[model samples]
Target: MPRSLRARKLENAVGLAVIVALAIASVLPLIHILYMVIVRGVEAIARIGLYRFLTEPPHPFDPQNPGGIGPALVGSLELSGLAIAVATLIALPASVLIAEFRGSRISRGTLLLALTLVEFPTILVGLTVYAVLVDHVVGGYNMLAGAVALTLVILPYMAVQASEALRGVPEGVREAAYSLGATRLKTVYALIAPAARRGILVGILIGLARAAGETAPLLFTVGGAYEGYHLCLYKVGGAVPLMIYQFIQMPYKPAQDLAWGAALVLMTIIVGVMLLARLLVKEVKIL
Candidate 1:
């Protein structure tokens, strides 16, 4: 090889090696976490039975107690579902408006605000929600309050991703729609939205996972409960993150074991969303 070509190839090889090394390093911690959770959690689930765990409330911090995380699981699901619904209502339209009206000042300002919101800390979000909805508006911490806080926490990231996805929709396709006498609304909803469905699906899953895993916002908005079945929007709610946090802090073997199980459940939920998204994408592609 010529000297220049040889030098370029060596540089490319070095860059590739560095990237591969970094990627492996990044994944190692995640793998370790998964390993630890599985090793400690699977036994608890097996001993307790999945159905029981999904239907019964937790027991006292006794190693011999057969407590389940049913309420916590339900709360987490309700909270995440509410956040997903509200966030989608706001984020999807906001994303399209930002992309469709990229030249307008309102669009520019809205997009900039969205990017800014993504950087806002979850803890701060919790505090704000607590002060407004919990302390003032509703007069106490409640499930709806937590759901609203989570929506605030997850909406920006989802909106930003959705906006990028809409932006990637081919301009030519939109122009063609316009030429065919389609209204702007039709082009945005029928054409651009469908074209960017996969990216929007990713945004939805990301928001759902983030909201489900968050403990701080729940701490402020929805205080934990014990041995009860309450999925009310206006009542204090149980959540897996709150359970795990409370359990891990106690100086008891049973609580610790329960924490591990709860962690596994939470991880499974987030992972399941990704798996579901993949299945959805596959179905859409097939159609």
Candidate 2:
């Protein structure tokens, strides 16, 4: 027998209410975290003038002020920039090959490797880099090792995204290119790449953001030299995430405050990149 109209209406209303409640429940934690970070971070930045807070190095012992994180800021830029560059250089071509040769044994193995690496423990990656490069080649923790670890961490993510993006290009586009007698390499470079540029760029930005915010990889790779900037890639360096990890553990109040500020800065950079990527996706009509 069919249900009465009133009973059916009540059931529909209850279902809608449950779904709304679940949605709010899922979002509540994120809202609370943002509130806490913003309140505490703003207070810390307010105590130290914005310019000084940004420009000076940490001064844990000083009674007057806790210095800024200039060295850390610079190190983060260097490591993230280098890692993104290397990861992009490797991911783009590898993704193209995988997308173009999905049936080949080599492509299958490469895709499987990337998929596995995407889920691999990041701390283990740092340790592996330490055992292979830092302990023997670099002789100590250095920017190069840190960047390499970050590159490994982000490479799989880039490759996966790039492959999906390349594959997503309309089949008609590929067919059109081949119908013109264009070789595989020429078709990929001239037609497929341009069509998939938005996704590729978004993937790169996401990887860069991840690289900038990563702390575990730096723990075993970068020596976390906090006194000043180590400009050379071969030298020990400091980054915002590493400093935050170190600072939050210190017993000093100033160090704790500095950690909050650094967290805010790292959060801002990641959020900005995400927002930019979103904007790109909205503005561009990817084929």
Candidate 3:
């Protein structure tokens, strides 16, 4: 082989090695964190009984007086659910409009506004929600306020992603739909939306995952309480991330163990959503 060709081959091999090394370095921290959580959490889960641990409130892990995390789980679900619902309602239509009219001044303005919103610090959003809802409106910290704040934080990201997904639908398909005498609205709703359904779903799932793990925004809005399960949207409730934060501050080993378990569960949920989104995208491509 020519010396130049051999040199190029050597360079390619070195580049490949560097890429592999970087990838490993990036992944190792995540793996280490997961391992630590699992190892620590498993003992707590086993001792408390999985069902009891998941269903009860935070209590000192005593065989006689074991308390589970059932209430926190429910509260997390409700808060996250409310946030996701609000974000979806706000994002879907906005995304559709932006995607369909990308070149218009309105679309341009909306895009810029969304970018601005997304870039705003989460603490700022939390403080704003606290001031407006807790001080000005509702008079105290509540789940509704927290949900609203989370929705605001997540909405811009979801909308921007949804718009990008809708734009990914081929122009040819849109033109053909128009040629078939479909109204512009009909073309968008029936044709473009269905075509990009996977992408939209992925965007929503990603938004949900992001919203679920947010701690700073929830801190000011949803004042963390250790009370047992309550469904009142006006009542403050504990969330996994908040609980983890609270637990880590305690000097007790049990609280720390429980924190690890909650962290693991949260991580699992986010990863599950991501995997489902990836599967949906893959399935859509296959079809």
Instruction: Give the 10-residue window scoring lowest on summed lDDT in candidate 2.
Output: 278-287
Q: Write the per-residue lDDT of candidate 3 for residues 147-174, one digit (tens) a residue.
A: 8888998899888878888998999998
- Go through the candidates in order and give the C-alpha RMSD of each one to the true structure: 4.1, 2.8, 3.5
Q: Which digits, one per residue and each the tens of the lDDT, describe model 2 over residues 1-287?
A: 99999999999999999999999999999889888888888888888878888878888656477887888999999999999999999999989878989889988888999989988889999999999889999798889999999999999989988888898898899899899999988999899989999889998988988999999999999988888879798889999999999989989988889888888888889889989999878642211
Candidate number achieving the greatest TM-score relative to the actual structure: 2
On a 0 to 1 TM-score scale, where does candidate 2 land against the true structure? 0.92
Candidate 1: give the clashing pairs. none
Off by over 4 Å in 1: 1-23, 278-287
lDDT of 2: 0.89
Per-model TM-score versus the true fold: 0.88, 0.92, 0.89
Candidate 2 vs candidate 3: the lDDT winner is 2
Task: Pull out the clashing pairs in model 3.
Answer: 55-70, 56-68, 56-70
User: Any idea what lDDT model 1 has?
Assistant: 0.86
